[model samples]
Structures are given as structure tokens and as C-alpha cells.
Target: MSFSTNQARIRCTQLAPRIGDGPGNLAQIETELASAASDGIDLLVLPELATSGYSLTPSEARDAALPADSPVFARWQAILGEHTSAVIGFCEHGGEDPSGVLIYNSAVILTPGSAPTIYRKLHLWDTEKSIFTPGSDVPPVVDTPFGKLGTVICYDLEFPEMPRSLALRGADVIAVPTNWPYISRPENEHAPEVVHAMAAARASGVAIACCDRSGEERGTVWTEGTTVVGTDGWVTGEMAASGRYDAAVELAGDRRRISPRNDVFGDRRPEFYEL
Candidate 1:
């Protein structure tokens, strides 16, 4: 897709419930995709492990994994092609090496003109460590119908290096599919994940579109701040509650001019940070 110097828009969805109900989840996703298309959004992002929900046992996670040849995946790819570029998460079954793990936590990218690219999550939360093995390689900054795009899973965003690595490698926009819980904290405290994403955006100069699941699942409640933060450290768009909702914003591109005054990348000195 050709990119113009003009504004680039992204629409994010904060999806709720349907955890582990594949058919029902697809219906919800389809409905939202149709709505976002009507709104003329260029891209749409969905939550983490949306297909199977979070907190599944290793066996359950493997059983929930969908094959690449499945109609459900094809249907989603076609839907994404028809509307806007999209990023969606699923727990996937990996290759059968009897000696290896059977499932992986992955985010799949689908655009109008290209084959779907899968990004396996490189980091795993404590519970997940028992099931999915860490991803072995990094995904490239994919060129889609929208622009250069990249993806990360739930816990991956907590570390600063991941997003920064993508930006320095040429990603213009980073799509994060997370299942963030809203555990009660002190009144003035922010969710640590929220703060992590904000700092990542400011440090990388890349637009961040994060979609986290909402509502209770397996006794855990998901936090309710699905947002799109720009490189300028501003919340360009946000969806505060659960259920299906969309947010659109014009994302900046990689062609931005380099300047010393406000150039976040230019001023960094890697040499002094070694500890």
C-alpha cells in the first residue's frame, strides 16, 4: 500500500468476554471489523490470546490452537483484507516435534495484499512459561496495507528493549495484544503496564496501539484502559471500558525528519548504560 505524507489513521478495539469461545469470539470480531470499516479506519488491533482467552492450562492451550489451514483463520484474513489491515492474537499449535512443545502464544498479521505473517511471543508470563516456549527469532517490520508494522504480546511490552528494538529496526507502528489485569493498586498508582507502554512510545518515536482484554475471566479481572499513544507522549486515542469499541488516529510515518532538539533516538548514548 502506498503511504502519503498525509495522516495515517488507526482504529483500536477493546474487546470483552468470549474468552475461549472461538466461534462466538469470531462473531464479535467480525461485527467490530465491519463497524470499524464503516468508520474508514486504516488499521484495527485486537486483544491478546483473544481466540482462547488467558490462563489456560498447557494442555488446554494446545487443544485450543488452530491450524494455519483452518477456515476460521482464512475467514479472518479475508475479512481483514476487505476492511483494514489487522493484528489479532491467538494461542497457536506449533510444529509437532514430539520432543518439543506443542503450542505457542502468537499474534498474526493480515493485510489485503499479503500473506499473513505470524509473530510468536518471545517472552512469557509466569503461568505461561509452563506451556509455550519462547519465540526463537524476531519478526521483521512488516509492510502492510497501512504501513510498516510490528507486533508484541502481553508481557513483551513490559520490557523497554522490545519496542525500542523494533523502532530502531524500522517499525513505524507497534501493535500490542495484551491481557492486562486491573488489580487494585494504591489510589494514585498507575498500572505498571500502562506506564511501560508510555515510556516505550516516548523512547522509540513509534506509534503504539495496544488492545487489552476486558472483563473477568477465570477469577481475574482485566484492566480497562485500551489505548493508542503517539510518539509525542500523548494519548491520541483511548477506550476506557470493556466490550467491543473502536478508536482511530492518524499515525506518523518513518519519513519524519531527524532533528537534534526533540529527537529521542539521536540523543541516546549506549556506551554509558552498561552496568
Candidate 2:
């Protein structure tokens, strides 16, 4: 497929959200949004549950949950520049009744002067099942001035089909809001989750920005693996001393073409393989 060549400055801000501290977390996010706007970032990605933090109990999750129409989103929108957009994860109050309240691990894409486009996390991690309801809808690909941005949560990236599906749907960049738990790995090796992200980017010929969280929560340490992978499947950005990963990547153009005669998507033989 052909695409117009466009450049975008992307930043992944790794934050340390305090568990259950909604006010404080919002303040931190607001500050970052202002800074991103000032820095001329076209796409800013934030860690999952950035507003409520990870490691929350059921009641804590509910307490931190915000409706999709929360005024805080508008506040965030006001802070963003005309060319800057952000994707942030938060606990969502899906619904409530006499039986119980539904909560979701959700991410919202905020564009200046536009309604927020929210995506609930379809795949929950190990303990997340106990607190959040898995999303039932497919991820959304939103059109922006920079490019078509696709949204996915942390664990959702583990499913190779997720990024592939987004690419098939014409996504230019995939913004992943993740909170990766620290896992042991061989020295000098990328974290397993980052490896999965890299492979996904290469296989789909799409750029991917994964924003991982920092700091420990409830005795669990974070990998702090915030990274950006280019269309060619190479690590283009890593966390800097400021705890942010920044990169200027191609948001447009025919990245699927690998060789003069070979195109990554064009060479697929789906008819013979059963997924």
C-alpha cells in the first residue's frame, strides 16, 4: 500500500503514578502535557493506568475510575497544542447498577478540539482480571494531522494478531500504553515485552511507541522499558535521563516494501495458513 511521506515527533513519557492518588496523578499528567506541547511533540504516549497507577484493589480501582466524559480530559485537551496529541491510560467507570459496577482498563486519545477516542484494554494481564473487565470491542485507529494512530494497552501487545490487525486497517503508528512488570532477562538483552513489540513492528511494517511506567508499586518493580521502534524493526528511541523516550519517525510512506521485488504485506500467503 502507498502512503504520503509524513514526519512526526513522538515522545513516550514514563511516569510514576501514585496508587489511588487521582489528584496528584492528574497534576503530573497535566504538567507533562504542557511540556510536550512546548517541546513540539506531535504524538505523546503515556503509560497504562497513568491516572490511577497499577496494583489497585477492586474498590480502589472503582474509586479511581473516571467516566469517559470526565472534565479532566477537557483539561488535558486545553493543555495540548494544535499539533500535539496524547494517549493516556486510566481506570474507566464503564457502568453501574444494583448488581455491580463495571470497570475497564482503558486508554483515551486526546486531540485538540476533538472528543476523546477511548479504547478499553481487550487483554488483561495476570492479576488485572480480578479488577478490570476485558474490553469487548476491537481497537480503534484514529486519524490525525501527523498520521493514523492506533491504540492498544500493555498486555494486548502480547497478541501478535493485534498489531497485525491494526496494520491491515491502515494504521501508521501504534501507540501502546503499558505498565510492564520487571522480569529477569539475560544481560544486555531487551526486555521480553519490548522484544515482542519490536517483532510486531517489523512484521507489520508499522512504527510502534510503547510507554512503560516507572517506580515500584505494591512490591512490584517496573521494567521501565519505554521504547520506540521504527518501521524497519529497529529500536529508534530509549528512555533518556529525563525518563522520556523521544524520536522523530516516519508516519507515512510505503514502509511495507522491503526489497525491490518483495513487500512485507504483499508477500503474505494467508490462503494457505490458518490462524
TM-score of each: 0.88, 0.96
lDDT per residue as tens, model 1, 127-225: 788888778878657886556888998889987889988988877789998988776777886677877877787777777888888778888888866
RMSD of each: 3.0, 2.8
The candidate that wins on TM-score is: 2
Q: What does candidate 2's lDDT look like per residue over 1-275, in tens digits?
A: 22334877889999999986899999999989999999888899999999999999999999999999998998898899787899999999999868699999999999876799999999999999989888999899998878888999998999999999999899889999999999999999999988998999999889999999999988999999999998888899656788888988875477888789988889999999788
lDDT of 2 at 221: 97
lDDT of 2: 0.90
Off by over 4 Å in 2: 1-5
Off by over 4 Å in 1: 1-5, 17-20, 240-250, 253-262, 271-275
Lowest-scoring 10 consecutive residues by lDDT in candidate 2?
A: 1-10
Residue 132, model 1: lDDT of: 84
lDDT of 1 at 147: 64
